[model samples]
Target: MSSHAPRSPFRAGAGAALGAPALAMGVSFLAFGAAVAAAGLGTGWALGASLGVYGMAGQLVLLQAAGTGDPTGATLGATAANARFLPMAMALAPWLGAGPRRRWLALPFIAITPWAAAMRVLPGLPEAARLRWFLGFALVSWLVAGLATWLGLLAAPWLRPPLLAALLFANPLYFALLLAAEGRLPASRLPILAGIAAAPLAVLLPAAWGLLAAGLLGGTLAFLARRPWRRGGG
Candidate 1:
């Protein structure tokens, strides 16, 4: 029964993986808010985008579209930017536990940071603890990002352009580093290599489609390359 003692998911998850990514997410959202303000949008608009969209890439696309005075393009761009979430959700489903209801409840929080953190940590946790840990980690990250967005909006008047740009690049840089760390594994090597090869080529594609193309092409190539090894292992 001692083995079944209650554990604090919040503490566990936070202690394990929430610190750096949460800070990176907060900085990224701060940059988003600053960008919105610099583009002449109100704080309320930035807050609304943060709350409703909750996607950094999509929010950036929306900001660009709004700046260009193209609402329709913004909508389409945001939608396209968010399309990556579908695959992310699919990849996370198995770890999130089995139930339509649970997945529905959890899917809203399935952003890149939380997903990556959960994926890195969940395999070692007991099955019973995985979902709770994920929820706790995601909740803290979401709250931190929202708060940082608000703060950034308030501070935008005093922030310099270069500093804002650094903030904007923070999360993506962190993510790249995380991926680099993960690439130490044999299976991740091929996918990382393929992505590196495809990224420059993908830039030749239309707006917002390049990332999608790069990911699809890279992932497909990686899967094909890994198949024989997987089959042999099986």
Candidate 2:
């Protein structure tokens, strides 16, 4: 009865809304709210930063750097840390349409994480429904995160030290949970192993440089390893 095949990527992207992604985001926002409040920032400021930046780790780095009296350096460092976004932009090009006009319009929407992930997986989905699926996932993630941030702001005032500690733990715990969930994916072991190898270097190198170096080195190794395996038995 349908004109097109079913789209697994769309379903997977949408499924995240009901699973780990949503939970991780919600918990992270709660922790971020408590931390920002404890650091003496205004609620409006926290909300504005989250809305504008949309990257939790980047926002935290900037907040810590600026609060310590290096606003300019912090901004520059944050910009550097976010350079991974360039690759993400390239990834979105196909779903956004190949035309220049469409590309320009798609730029703003690129900030949405769900859309970014959907783009990565959309090639495996039904061609006709890919865009719709991407939009659905992006909209839901955006709305939910926005609402959670606002709610967290309202609740921040009452957050005791114990509660704040609990909130802080949520972030790391969620990341661990996400890694566990991703174990089922093909080639997932590569990222897990790379992350393990990079852990010490992550502490030794400066924040921006460490992230960039790890990404480049790990990606290069992964690509080189896969090529030989793909070519023939290696």
Candidate 3:
């Protein structure tokens, strides 16, 4: 008889990310890889941005600004596009730990996909398991994004024009799918509903500010809707 080691929670979490969501993420980054190749930024830059930026929209923003030959504007644009991460990190903090040290370690990984999945999945997990699970999932997702970016760049030049257009929609479509999948959970749906409903009103602002407003507003509404003050002794 052969024996296999029992998987840790971290490995289990990573396995979860290997499914449909990760596939969509990889498909979506194909466009980004193409864009990076088109931009002449090289594979190193594409992979670095995929890891360091983490957000698809932010990577696009950085790519666009890079063309202007102004590193400052590129940096600012990417930062602005990813401003939604501020509220996300805040919302995820209590789940990671009460200590700033733990929070800081995990906060950097709070991109849309992992954060959304975490919000939907973490409450049911043991407190000790949540952080490890989250890290495992997010790290795998990040690696997949980086790998897809390189592959996309290599394949982009050979891909048909129409196929490239289709790839661009994959990420947003995955987000929509995730929202629908999590809709069964009432608590989890609150912020998603709020963000979608409020995003239109935010259109008056710049893209980054609009993103920030939607995330902040949605997170605040969800937090308050839960009425933590009554529940909190912390």
Candidate with best TM-score: 1
For lDDT, candidate 2 versus 3, the one ahead is: 3
Residues 84-121 of candidate 1 have per-residue lDDT tens digits of: 78888888878876365766767668888888888787
Task: Give a tens-digit lDDT track for model 2, residues 86-112.
Answer: 666776767653345534644544553
Q: Rank the candidates by TM-score, best first.
A: 1, 3, 2
Q: Which stretches of candidate 3 lie over 4 Å from their true place?
A: 1-6, 97-104, 218-234
TM-score of each: 0.90, 0.76, 0.85
Q: Return the clash pairs for model 1, or none.
A: none
After superposition, candidate 1 runs with Cα above 4 Å error: 1-6, 228-234
Q: lDDT (0-100) at residue 10 of candidate 1? A: 60
Better of 1 and 2 by TM-score: 1
Considering lDDT, which of the candidate structures 1 and 2 is the better prediction for this target? 1
lDDT of each: 0.82, 0.65, 0.82
